[model samples]
Target chain A: MKTQPLVIAGRTFASRLFTGTGKFSSSALMEEALLASGSELVTVALKRVNVADADDDILRHLGHPQFSLLPNTSGVRTAKEAVFAAQLAREALETNWLKLEIHPDPKYLLPDPVETLRAAEELVKLGFVVLPYVHADPVLCKRLEEAGVAAVMPLGAPIGSNKGLLTREFLEIIIGQSRVPVVVDAGLGAPRTPPPPSKWAPTRCW
Target chain B: MSFRPIFESHPWDDVKASIYAKTGADVERALAAPRRTLDDFRALISPAAAPYLEQMAQLSQQRTRQRFGHTVQLYVPLYLSNECQNICTYCGFSLDNKIARRTLSSVEMLAEAAVLKGWGYEHVLLVTGEANQTVGVDYLEKALRTLRPHFAHLSMEVQPLDQEDYERLIPEGLNTVLVYQETYHQDDYKKHHPKGKKSNFHYRLDTPDRLGRAGIHKMGLGVLIGLEDWRTDCFYAALHLDYLERTYWQTKYSLSFPRLRPAEGMLQPKVEMSDRELVQLICAYRLLSDEVELSLSTRENPTFRDHVVQLGITSLSAGSKTNPGGYAVAPESLEQFEISDERSPAAIAAMLRRQGLEPVWKDWDATLTALAR
Candidate 1:
């Protein structure tokens, strides 16, 4: 079955199965897993990688031509910190695409809606492709889209929680009315659990 | 609001009475409740819950595996100093003990770090007694700077400081801070900590608030078991945890249960916590909150530690020395407490592997603090 390709920030993605580089026991294992997933777009936490070294353990494994590194501001707590981290990530990874995540709360890693919106607007003005991680709030998703986010990565549940699709109703609402891409991020857990199909297009997950 | 107000509202005697008054019905209700509350926690830890230990253990093991998987994080404690101004009744490092006190120098600190690094320990907890003039913020900052490059995660178990002090240390790559309220009993707290800065019970009670305000990445809180009534003390600890989680929504939290062990010139435990009771407490904590991290140290015997690992423990420290420079620099230095589980890290890791649990050496990275500047 040939699925429709998803386009975000003017870049074409052949695979909608985006992956993340975290919690793997080793970089080699992470590389193998990401490769097996056949994900073209992989998100790497800027806080987890050594950006100064080109051959950093985690970075060295992510050099495949098919992989587009989406450096995320995972540790930043405020809008200013997110902007600073994004700039550093851009210079180090040499890509303007970012997963804007300003989560001050570490327990659940829930995104700060205020900080995400503020950072998204500033990041977009700075000529970066901002994909903000946020809650499954329909109004907040619309607000992020209005603020010029390339896509809104609304969480299915708390990050890393294996409980699947706790926020299905809100996700459906966001997917129904979203103008930009709606990538369901976090809490999808299993590989076989597919993202909900949208009426207009297929929803993405990372 | 700080936890001070909440702590003040819940009188110790009343809470203890309520926990003791819980009936079997309350315990059953708490066990059956889908979402356990603090009240449910009372029933779960009460004497009535003793009969349901097996069921509680099963649920706890399932919940722990569901959340943390079949993995246990490994860490070792590097005792940096035993110098103290406080006269803690249960500690060998108490000022009045008259033992030879030692504080690890920068050279000595790295030597200890080298030994732990050789053991494949990426997480190290630096322990010290409360002595302001010698082992203050300046000394701690230098220690972090010296040891940060060697370890992936660094935690401190030292004297409580103001919020500003934690703010300074966090930028220096300090990941977690463990400040245990020895006991929540006010008069007994004063009795145990008779002298020095630690005698300030309210100040110590509010230390977590300072850490949270300082934007610490993680903070650990617990009450020393066998201090007063273990049940009441732990209830207060849980209440404090609940308040901190709501207030410091940004910071991560961990809980520890340190049963008093034999130490030189130390007083006997006021209340003894049986191994079975401790197991009940661990399982009750898991049922209460699945998100919080639970840790057990080397104070327990190997058999107890091994058995409880399956119950609810998320992290464990093996091959720990509770004295200054006991690792490599000054092995002859006086230890603050006697450790029971003296198994090497490799041996412990092997044991974990045998039990179908993976031993995780490095779960955090130093690069997380790269943007602190």
Candidate 2:
């Protein structure tokens, strides 16, 4: 049977790959990669965009009808800051959607699950469609799902380490129990290969 | 969400002292038994377990090999920024330290990621400091975006954020967040973190609670060694881990022993844990919870790291840089702390091979992230 589109918080995503506008050699290359990956929901960090300017480089390049922008509160370290960033993103990008990531440690770039949960609870109450970045704990996935999260993004490994899922058992648990959707975030695929575990590492296993 | 009792409150010191007072017979019971409990772990970690160290080693080695197989999950940290507002005494990037501050622009993050990718890494850690205004959530999101396209999976290590923040990041293709309680000793923690948001020891102490409520996928926990009595802090960490595992049954947990290292204007660690003690802790973690991950970093010397892998460590970091763009951008910039085992990824891989263990490089998928969207 063919896979169906993933619907989250009332929005339907035709493609599963959530492309980012950050890494390509150029925006054109990023666009090419995004198209090739067949991703519909694209995530962009609110930091890179010049929200005050109507014309922003990355934002303009990401302007496509088929794609949805997921402005993430990646920089804010507190729930309060994330709430403010989310409000700003909602106003500037004209969308009540956000990706919440709060981490205090800079060395390993680890996420703070405590603050993330707090934010998810409040954001859901605030009417903003929230997606959270967390570990591969299955129960947490369920809780976020219960908290009305669009999806649960659990790491295959540490972010940008390209380490791929070190927490395999946990990821499996999260995947098995997730209700909304289980997106294997961070540390799965190779930057260059992007396909095989040895070459690219992203398994479309979902 | 009804659950079993989290844990019966025991003064962490008492538990440590009890662990310290374990006799060889206790270690024998701990080793000879089919199933072990927290008490058994105490026996195994106690000083009296010394004469039986060789015996403990054999058991730990066998248990580890059996559970983990002959493999090691390898990862590298891409330091994206070093700006901070928190005044953590033992940290390299503590706000009080007058060091150079750097935050990677979207492009710089990619440049740094390219280096990690070149090392055959599939999982990446997007690391940064706690400068809310500059390298805040938006900055992290952008970094993940910049990285998500290139990497299969993404993980981050930065400042803690609210639950909604984590929830939101989930949609953006960001995953696991690891937060270590430098010390569970609230008063000592306050002394270490004298200013900034991090100074709120209660908020930091209650972080896992928030993570549980937010429903994060997995949360890694640890207490920085040298900040407090390792045993007591670890007991609290174990207690917290037990509670977290039970309370947030769905979330996974991992532990790291981040010993205080000499950094730019960083304070000296109060108690230096010997390599022997660290091994005991790792083995104890395994004995206590067979499933929990024990990660060893490059902070330790090559010799010590080489030995501990055989003891219980499931995850290892090979070539790591602690400063932003340390991998590629500003190679000579002030590192968060000096790394001891400066081995290349290949060297670490070779080392694992020599020990009859395979080095695991990739763990997540870009297609999965894409597929989830």
Candidate 3:
């Protein structure tokens, strides 16, 4: 049986997999792995690509017709910086879809829920499809939904930790409560245990 | 808000003892750690880490190359004045030195700038002895106005000024300020700077805070290497750097290691920092922070400066004149300190190219700051 397509911000994704472009040894290898994953949505960090350069290595590899770019404000630490970087990325990458990430603490890469909520509200008002990466806190998820974010991406663990579903209980709560599509964005180590097919399936996993 | 509290808390003796107490195990731990801390910096600069010089040098070279690439920013110092009210014990420009004091007139300053421009220097450091009367904010403002159109970047190594003065000069195209705490040891500091405004250790210590608050683009920091225990003094410098970096996140910081050089009738260096030890200190700084610009001045010998470009140095001064009008206007004047490397700027640029590094003359522009405004 065919599964239902995940719809977010008036766009439908045929594949449930969302891929991230980081930590690959080579851009070619990253492109190969992403193609193999068959992800229709890919997240690219604004810090990683020289957005002004059309021939940037990462941008050069991500020209596939099926993929839609989600530019992320990854290195920004405050609502002000997030807004500035989002505007720059929107202009450079030519995309209104943004991954609003504001992590003041660099060591843990934990999202600042307050700054995230503030930036998300502003960005949504500015007509952006804002997808905010946040902790698997159900309350924060509901707050982001109220802020009019396009989607809520809750982490399974600290970013790049390779520890799957460390916040499983909170993820379940966020999935149950969130009105927008809930995407599991970080720290899924392996594909062994996908959340069992159910009414509260994650919109996409990266 | 100021670095004074943090500076006072890290007392010299306590910091010295902690650094000297670092064992070989601590050095190894620091070397192996992926992300180093200030404690790791203490370990790296400790005498116990001398045997690991090669390892530290390799890491420093790699880190420097990764961050700054194969280029060395070239700058020349334009000595605007030798006038001073401070009686620094080790300086020829001291008030009690009884030498003819000279402050370059606007015409003389323009003449000096013409010579530096001829040498293809785009970054010029304006140096002056502490004389608020002769080389005060007004003099500096006019000098910057005269020279700003001739160069892309302007730095000053003059007397410490108030925050408002710095704020005023910054808009006049002053991009950088170098304020070295001659020594961090408070009592020893008093011994060096006996009288005059320099004797106020607290004010001198808090100058970086003032500069940061004034929104200066960059600030260079160091302690004159031969004053006290070099390791402890550097630790305090590093501490100050860490504080300022966190406090004023927008300002870029650079590090200079100026060992005491012989001047006419100047006091001898109490504690000598050998070339190997200086190398160790330079590498330690690179390992500590990958982004802080490491600068080598003309005080170092030609051979040493030639070799150090590959290590961790990001900026170098070529054909420097430490006396007012020493470049062309008044070559007979007594220099603040005798320059060891007298190589011309062209010679240094060629040497950098021979080592497969490009010599960058202009890396910043006033238009960029104007555009930001």
TM-score of 2: 0.63
Stretches off by above 4 angstroms in model 1 are: A10-14, A20-71, A84-97, A122-129, A146-148, A160-163, A189-206, B353-358, B365-367, B370-373
Q: After superposition, how far is residue B186 of candidate 3 from its true place, in Å?
A: 0.4
Top-down TM-score ranking: 1, 3, 2
- Per-residue lDDT of B124-186 in model 2, one digit per residue for the tens? 777788889988888877887778877656777888888777766765777567888888776
| B227 Cα displacement, candidate 2 (Å) | 1.1
Scoring the B chain of model 2 against the true B chain gives a TM-score of 0.93
Per-model DockQ = 0.27, 0.02, 0.05
**TM-score per model over all chains:** 0.88, 0.63, 0.69
Classified by CAPRI criteria, candidate 2 counts as incorrect
> Candidate 3's residue-wise lDDT over A36-57, tens digit each?
8888888988755655457766
Candidate 3 has what TM-score?
0.69
lDDT of 2 by residue, A1-206 (tens): 01466677767666667766544434555676776777878888765556654665567777778878898876555666677777778988998878877654432346777878888998989999888888877777787788888778887777654556688778766665566666777766565523323312222225
TM-score of predicted chain B, candidate 1: 0.99
**Which candidate, 1 or 2, has the higher DockQ?**
1
Instruction: Specify the poorest-scoring 10-residue window by lDDT in model 3 chain B.
Output: B364-373
Model 1 lDDT on a 0 to 1 scale:
0.88
Instruction: Point out the worst 10-residue segment of candidate 2 chain B by lDDT.
Output: B1-10
Could you give the C-alpha RMSD of every candidate to the true structure, in order shown? Answer: 3.4, 14.0, 7.9
